[model samples]
Target: MHLNRRHFLGTGIAASALLTAPTVWGQAKPKVVVIGGGAGGATAARYLAKDSGGAIEVTLVEANPVYTTCFFSNLYLGGFRDFESLQHNYDKLAGGGVTVINDMATGVDRAAKTVTLAGGQVLPYDRLVLSPGIDFKDGSVPGWSLDAAEKMPHAYKAGPQTQLLKKMVEEMPEGGVFAMIAPPNPYRCPPGPYERISMIAHVLKQKNPTAKIIVADPKEKFSKQALFEEGWNKHYAGMVEWIGPDFGGGKVEVRPDAMEVVIDGEVTKVDCCNVIPGQMAGKIAALAGVTDDSGWAPVDPATMKAKADENVWVLGDSSAQGDMPKSGFSANSQAKVAAMTIRGELTGSKTFPAKYSNTCWSLIAPDDGVKVGASYEPTPEKIASVESFISETGEDAALRKATYEESLGWYAGITADMFG
Candidate 1:
């Protein structure tokens, strides 16, 4: 389990890789360990190494070698994209001088400032960035547990579960019922469930037009609600049904064994069920003692540094910073600020005022996209929204198509920025 000098340097990279930390220089380098390789962690790792120009040793710890992006998994379900198009590997990060380790972080010793991997390798770090994404809150939904995921797939983390959900949708019997148990607010990707509904409807429209999709939501309103409703009526009229909290959307339970969903004490048989439970910061954040009582990690709005631990920074869906939603764009924006602050503290790199931005784009159907976004700055109390914009309902098809294309460009640019 010991990572000898040679093995540590040569295992995931070339013998002459810059990830070796300039051992010949006879000076200790500040080691930065980033746990999680999603939008936030990967970008933080890449920026830390690139902006530092090899002055610091950066190690990225990820549980998966290839990431399946949850942001656009809906598109894959709609058949607009393939699974391969959604996957990005870590070889580019490894080649770019980051010590990319495909390992799960099991524990964090704060006083010792060391991270323990599931394989028993311990990594010492001057600073740690934790962006492990979201995990379902225990018992958030009655009769649903992680053990029940295979039967009623959440598909919230992407990858295999996404494929499972898609397959379930595609294999639905003619005129079968598809049901979704939407999560509450303050969860990752505010517009994700609705977009998912649109994609599933798109699939059913083509494969089984008589099939029906149902959404039992706890919230009275959702992101882009007006736009989504308009699109649903225009594109998939009478095929999709949304029951809000006023109609007892909040009271729901599922019996995965019988493939039944209970809304407001009324049981209905469903051919497929996607039970998205409440969420919290990833397990590693709690393991590291960074999360607060709210089941999320609180961070300084200015620098994304963990309020509980100065040596730690939490990003993405794991962070409960004020005002910013837990989207990939928000995480990427926060990571840049945190990366700059870390560089400034360790390498004396000049730091600027922390400003962040995020834009979440969703596809209603093929060539129809809508978006919501805002610019923000760190205030004394929270990260406050500055200026905001959203796509209005009834926009021209050309504009919607343009918005979808814009999102495609962002995906390409952000992935390149994160991976390389």
Candidate 2:
């Protein structure tokens, strides 16, 4: 069956609906410390508190008061969503009796199982859940680093970078070149840069119809390539160009100061450049000693618990689970399993068998959306895909529109799931 948000979330398939524990007033509640406020952490934190009914003391340590989801950020550029709509607060989670802290977690002492914050407070955890999102690999892109972000924004993390990239695209001179250096594989949002290109094209197609987009991608093929290419051709013909590694797309560099893109040693001046370098798990996961040499935390596929420490669980973009893409939906799915397992271990709560699912939706144009998804069962080896589905290339307009509408509902439902 094609699982929509209603069936996926409402049916308790995404998370266990009955996560109850016998609450005791005289007892010390088990404490769960969740780091990062993205899909994984937020969902885990919310579910831990909401279901535990005061049996688990959930303290969420997030650096930001408002979370700007990277999922729907592309729509903001396409004029489909406003900036404020992408931002969500912890009000619902707080109302559910969760202690939400806004502070950076600087270090983790694994032996002590304590997280040290930037503000000098050390938090102890019976269970530590780290769902910190992706962080760029230093020097992954030639001549591009975090310092050069202002000149050539990656916009990968959302928030100010998203707004900056939008402003840069809007302010570009007519017919100017909008260049993008796509990240390599194993990056966040497999089809993100492409969808971003489409959204940017959507904006430029209307405001700066003469603007040109050049994509230098390391991979020859991308997720939903046919769908995106078809839409680009049908909607924004002659306005977009994609260069793959076969065409020296991989041997590319950016000169942020000069606002230029060097493709295969050939220099081209660009009005705006979006440089997305290779990525790895966020810094906190590495600090916690949960991540492997690959910079992603390896976890037991069955429980989403890090192999390094059973007391710790990793979720979202930081986890090296198999098959599932590093998407918000996947993270949210994984968070539920992790949360339930932790609750069972800590509070002796009712536990359910682990089931996971994910779907990634990309909008190629206004009301034109495509998606790929799968349901999973965890083996000792990996979280393997048992069933899968994708939008067909020749799908009708009504289907595409419906897919887009489904994505919107998913956004609404998922945000409610995470923060509430």
State candidate 2's TM-score: 0.93
Tens-digit lDDT track of model 1 for 1-420: 445743663443553355566555433578899999999999999999989999889999999989988888889989999999999999888887899999999999999888999988999899999999999998888999989999999999999999999999999999999999999988999999999999999999999999999999999899999989999998999999999999989999999999999999999999999999999999999999999899999999999999999999999999989999999999999999989999999999999999899999999998999999999999989999999999998899999999999999988988888887
lDDT of model 2 at position 58: 91
Best TM-score among the predictions, by candidate number: 1
True-structure RMSD, every candidate: 4.5, 8.9
* Model 2 spans > 4 angstroms off: 1-27
Q: What's the number of clashes in each of the models?
A: 0, 0
